[model samples]
Target: MMSFLPQLSLPLPHHCSSSKPFQNPTVIALRSPTTVSNATTDSGIQFRRKLLYLRGLNVNALEALRKNPEFRSTPLRTLKSVETCLASMGIERAALGRIFDMYPQLLTCDPYLDLYPVFGFLLNDVEIPFPDVRTAIIRCPRLLICGVDDQLMPTLWFLRKLGFVGRQAITCQTTVLLVSSVENTLLRKLEYLRSLGLSCSEVANMVLRSPGLLTFSIENNYRPKVEYFLREMKGDIVEIKRFPQYFSFSLERKIKPRHKLLLDHGFSMSLSDMLKVSDGEFNLRLTKLRLRCLEEFPSAEVLLLNNLFLISVLTPKDWKRESSISCFYLYQLPLLDVFVYWLKILGCVNPLIVLDFYTFPILQFSSIIFIFLKCS
Candidate 1:
């Protein structure tokens, strides 16, 4: 079983022969401790510190600096500290991003403008469940524009997206209240509000609350939609259509004291005719009609003097101070002196005239007599 014999040498493979192959050589030399120290120092201060610290203690030198108070306040140092603390404590990036996202850039740009308090209040009070800041940046409150020429605004569209249909409804309701209160005429504002899914009761409440909001104007005469809102809200709220509205003559843009009064008084034409008529009728349907435009027509003294004669013959209720009339608002005819005199003669002590010229009209000498007469 143990036969020892000499074997012949076979030819080696081509790849295995060292002399025929192209080979690359790499040289590596282990340095002394002084050389290692010098090499580590040349790398960087932080690198050198990390290298030295890694050899002895278990943790990095940056981790040691994190607990140092001297490097605490500066933003860069604080950031480094936070980074190390987060790494050591194993905090995730996603959670920090979620909390930081609530801070608005505008607030951050000017925090000393009391922005922090305002932002904090809004953050606490407005409990909208938005997934992130992007959602809040896009949405806000909206105001529904009504009147004959109303146009939608960008905010209105945004509000609609945010489920604010009430503004649109309010506009319609306002029109309905306007038409219903004023001589029972129908308006389109009511219909539009109804279309926006608000009830008649809602519109009535709005009218009672914001009466001065009646002065609304929109673009060149669109077919306004307010008829339904008025029809439905009728009788539910107090009638405010012809309720004694007043405007101080002092505040009027054009009309002035010492100016010849253009008493564009009672309308002889029917309501239909007046509605159908053009602006040219402003001259014909007015009270006094012929008062000058001040620049052209010299003195109104003649007309005022002649009117005094007429004033003598008429009863107090019919006292026609025609040419000298100061408050000549045609639309609000029920508030003129003629109606006030009539109301007074009919034992109306408490006159509800719009033009109450108390101090100027009633002098100190005549005041006592007037008071005596009123008391009697």
Candidate 2:
């Protein structure tokens, strides 16, 4: 009976424990729950760090884990599946870091339930083409985090009602606007524009023409620009309705500088002419205006120095071909000297040239010089 019983390990007696406390071999052989739990936790953390490192998210992996609690417990395979899903939709491996960094909650999102539905809505409901699906996501990464039923569907409905359908339908280029809140963001901007003496239809037309109008902030962008347009430029609201892109131009950089330049020269330009052109083109147009001013009013020789300097800098081939003047001649000559030289060249061909400053407007003066230059 004793032999049949299993042999048991016994603890050492305190008296026979040599200098040590009595110990049980069985107890020493097993690990505590805390130790096992700690080992598991450490392994899980290391695995997550490796996963993020492999996916280019090492830059902010710890921050992501801390911020998104779901990420800490999410299975390794689930995180990989999210990456695989985005990759299938044309999101580049490099772009994944930036997207995840911006929205770390996406790390734990179920690909089928959370991510694929957004892609489907973009492709099917928004009518975004397959290739442009990547563009929309890259442009507005928040689109993935937004719920299709709560955020995206409601926004799309509001936009369609506001006349974003047909040719002016929301496309990949303007898909970023879809993430904006309908009550807090989109409607507020529309109502603000309407409050500025524009009818609802007029505001809708402006937004259709320039979708970026909806993105402008009321305090930072809309208020200041509208105030400047009315107070300083005395701009007509009708112009803004026709060219809503007027709001897109920087108030400090493009609007003020160009508007001041035109005011200094006693000239007025449409918002399109003032802002729609490049810096070089604007300078060329200003120089042309000064040239017209000089020819119309010979007494205004002061215009020549500034105008000639601009001509020297912005020397178009057409001017060189028309004048037959070398670059050195234009650069070196004083305003009066250049004016005299031009007159001498014109006198040879149109000896009977007449000056009528009062009859013709300053803008038409360029035609007179072109006529003489062509005849020569």
Candidate 3:
């Protein structure tokens, strides 16, 4: 049987002791329709009205607007001006959804006053075409937020000094430097480039070629790579000027290993070919080197494994470590039933490819020795 809860009585004032059971006055007050009306504010009501005026925003955007102090307090005239500004620019009605979704502050800020000069300077003063101007503004909405004299002009002048006068596609890569602060990013990076023993003109040329270099950390990326190239690779300032993209590639990953491998093999590859190519392209170049070796030794123990890799990947007992790494990466193996091809290749006695035994990165170098000895 269920235990019944005991009902206790307490004395109450004559006004409160009614026939109906008592409820909390505060609870009743809280649940009132007027209380809800009070909580729903003038700013809140205006925010909803603003949402209605703006086309294509959903419930999620409405919730964001409610919490946004700047957007919530935006004046009617300013909101009207933003709408007018977008219209004056050829920003299609459908595009406003995306534009506003990212930057609601655009609605309050006077775009005609704030943004016009930026567009004007880029298009007319710099002679950046209308299409490029449109692309820069739309692609990076932050372009609207950047000040003309303070942020935008200085960045343009810096880029102009680097010889970027009229060539204005405003690529995603270049736009990053354009929007970044001057004292910290643009000016500081200029100083670091100068420290690399480059004249102002050479530095400007380097910047023009590889705008992304400015973004690299002086300590982490620029200095370490420069030191390695100077001390290890014996590179000169002129050599760095020829290929500033050297700094873009990883020092530990691409530069050090590839340069060492080329020197060891007596194969002289350019900085561009070595650091720039995809893994497949790099392998192809190595295969070409292997073929050159085959010509040097007609009965060479080394075999060319397709046009992508060297025979050492499949043939050499000593190169089992390299072979295992290759097998893991050579994804151009059969799309369907990939592991099955390895079995067929290993079974062949002529030009034996027995290193294909393991699928996972094989640490066991014994496989190579065992296969070769058994074949002999």
Candidate 4:
């Protein structure tokens, strides 16, 4: 009881000695190791890549990884394996949805929006369903759709919601093609393409669908399409490829009870060749024409027109007397002017001739006419 007054706080140094030196207080620098920073850099790299992914450039990241010395040694094949990963960064939601059943986890990830190459082929029926699809359409201002039937209409409608309607969203600048089958589908696709500022090419494989489209009609329609492809896109297309069921012509004209055309749903010709061939059926009956690559025309080859028109003329000069071709139709010829000059010397005037000249600039139309007029 004597000193009860301040027994209060005799500094208990034993209990509170500088907070026990923080337990590990030797002042451990707290600096991260280079390895830790490197690991962090890796995470930062992925984060940066995520930025690119959001910007719709995942491909560039992998491409850089492939070229960068640090990761260049990684197997290139693995890149393909990671395509799904990269594609998921900004690829079309509809396309992702197509494969969603297989990879359910990807549905929640953000998609990269790409303006696909303009000349690409669309072989499958790509469905852009509601809600999320609408968001996707809002992202891609211009889109290309191919394949037969109404499968692409949903995408069009989805796009329409994004203020891409009536040639505003899609116009001659946008392309929507319907492959060989489905009549109504072609009309729908054409309407959609025209709306998105695109004009569809009546390509070799897809021409038959545009009804009342004669050779000349097809050619006329094709010219602008070709020009658009050449000018705006420098010859490219948006693709929606699918496994096509290609059919081949029957060797026999008579339909075999069980035989059908071979099924191949892919490109069969080079880009230029495809353009040339797409206009083929149009001008089915040409007269007084100059052709380039006459030898390359399948029609000429099939009917032996080259052999009939040129080879026949090459026979003995006396045979030339019997080789008078009035109202001649030439296909795939390159030297039309020269051939015409030769024909003029032989007194072949007023003959109705059909021509399918090949590999020349359409801009030369005026010069060609002047030449023809001078020769006439």
Candidate 5:
């Protein structure tokens, strides 16, 4: 067979028969074996790298991380320190998976500063019982994210101020302190309750009883409801102190309707009874006091006060004519007293206030109701 390919032999340069065969530049370069070896090594590395995103980074724990519900999704920037942080805290893999389930974000936090400091504070400063520390962390993970100086210490100090100050105070208060804020929550609620006439001791007892109240907002949750209790509902400080749960009830849903109903019927239900009753019970109590009684059961004469009655409703112009004092000019005691007797047996105060007609206006009616309910 005829060879069609060029040979690597000495066809020698035609012009100079003795000239050595010319070497191809490509072959000459290939002839330097180290270059071929280096090129092969470089290409092999490139191919290997392209096979995997993070080449040469051994993650024997990658399979375990797959079991972590959150760590796999955790941003690399945060995941780098998460396991180390968890391990430094002596958190085993089994427990860490559960922790991540609840607080996946904790995995991304700084292990040394953000993490150990918080753990140290809980274990050392606040002295959260070591056994209970896990439960507390499970309950509230922000201990990892929040700084001890700014967020945590202030809250601890406030909790201490709240009468968690005794030797057992830290143990008693650590859980709730981790859950709330000092400036935004605990402090504001304390100040507002004090403003509501809760004495220092009373406020302390209320907070110790229900730490969640401190989490309620001052402007939205605490203030408006408190104003309604004190100003509109005419509730006594003692009433709420006696029943601190008053802070928990929804104003729109519970307090307003019951209060307005009682006021319109001239009844004065105790604040505790007013807020605590279920809607069904409240409606049942209200139904017993007929709508007709609101307007039709006019105030009878004060003489019949003990008979569960009062005088008929009279216009302001005609009040002087029908006024118990006017009708019974023969009475020794004041008409207000007689009317007070009129509504007491009937379990309402409106008729008495109404009996004064123009004398006792809305605010005055509230005052009389307040004084009467409190005194009663």
Candidate 6:
């Protein structure tokens, strides 16, 4: 055709010289299994790195990949959808890293199929408010991984039967209780409290009042505190029933130190008063007790009643009103020295008297001086 078309020149196969079309070197390289595998590995690594960076996870990406193999095969769009689902539920971006690090399986969960059911149970069944759903999840990240039908629903039913209903219903603060196993954990704790002589109603009230009570380990928390309270502190079980929060205090750090200090000073306080005050306030109370000279005369009320002259001076009205006057005010009277001096001069050598200024309605000091002079 002039032979119109030019003769085509193509590289022949080294082995077969068949009439097969030549493939581009670039295309051949791209189609190689080794090259494809390397590309896929690189893409997966890049995706994992991106996930780590986006979630603020301070972890080794390779370790996470190894721990969660499913995460490697999951497509990026699917992961983004999971992130979006959590974000829509009020979970902060920063918390996602911790949550994912703790529960890497969450990374591959189908947002609708696996995740929404949990949120639904928390909202509808548990009655956790929409805003507090984030709090419940953050407080117990395991809640996200818990199965709705198997774990959560059963736990809710158990708690309600144990009296976590009505005004004493579970709240965001107590959502951690949802993760406890009814048989191994929750019921065992309840039974232990019952073994302490608490009725079912009483145990329920205690747990309702202090939700952390159910979380305490009997071997670690309950037994030690109860032993100290009974054997060392000589406290009654009734006190524990009244103040179940008593177990919440640390034995070594708080309860022991404070109780030891009180015993050292021969002072006694109710459980609530002893453990509830700040360290500074407790020390201040002890100081004031010392200043009042209460340690020297522990029976000041009885001693005051036995003093005939002091009793005679107190009119019926004054006697009735004296009950309102605190012993602190009685000891810190402004003219206490003058009263003591007058009493000493009147043949009362040891005058440990407690007087209130308002005990004499007309003239405070005048009435005391008149009474002492008239007696002399």
Query: For this target, which candidate reaches the highest TM-score against the unseen true structure?
Result: 2
Residues 1-376 of candidate 4: C-alpha lDDT, one tens digit per residue: 7777666534544656754443644565666698789988887776564435423522344444433434333333333333454343345434433333333222232223221221121212232232333244333322322222343455445444433443343332232321222244444444533443434442212323322221122234434444444463343433211100111112133112111211021112223222232222212212122233232333221233432343222212222222333333334356666677786686654222333243223332312211111112
Residue lDDT tens for model 1, 1-376: 2356557566656766755543644568879999999867765665454335323423333543444433222333333343343233233443323222332122112232322332232234232222322233222101111121122223233323323344443232222222222212223443433444556665444434443333332121111212221352121212222221211112123222112233122113322233333333432333233222211222221223212211122224432233232332233434455655764686645432222111222231211101101212
Candidate 6 — which pairs collide?
1-4
Per-residue C-alpha lDDT of model 3 across residues 284-361, encoded as one tens digit per residue: 576457434532432225554322222333344333221221122333434323444553466533332323322222
Relative to the unseen true structure, what is the Cα RMSD of model 2? Answer: 11.5
Cα deviation in Å at residue 70, candidate 2? 3.7
Name the 10 consecutive residues with the lowest summed lDDT in model 2: 350-359
Report, for all candidates in order, the number of backbone clashes. 20, 0, 0, 50, 5, 1
Give the TM-score comparing model 4 with the true structure, all chains together: 0.21
Ranking by lDDT: 2, 6, 3, 5, 4, 1
Predicted structure 2: lDDT? 0.75
Residue 218 error, candidate 1, Å: 24
Name the candidate, 5 or 6, with the larger lDDT value. 6
Between candidates 1 and 5, the one scoring higher on TM-score is 5
Q: For candidate 5, lDDT tens digit of each residue in 118-156?
A: 888888878777767766765666566778898888778
Worst 10 residues of 1 by lDDT: 364-373
Between candidates 3 and 4, the lDDT winner: 3
Model 6 regions lying over 4 Å from their true place: 1-34, 37-41, 44-48, 51-63, 294-376
Q: What is the lDDT of residue 219 in candidate 3?
A: 85
* TM-score against native, each model: 0.17, 0.72, 0.58, 0.21, 0.47, 0.68
Q: For model 1, what is the C-alpha lDDT against the true structure?
A: 0.31
TM-score of 3: 0.58
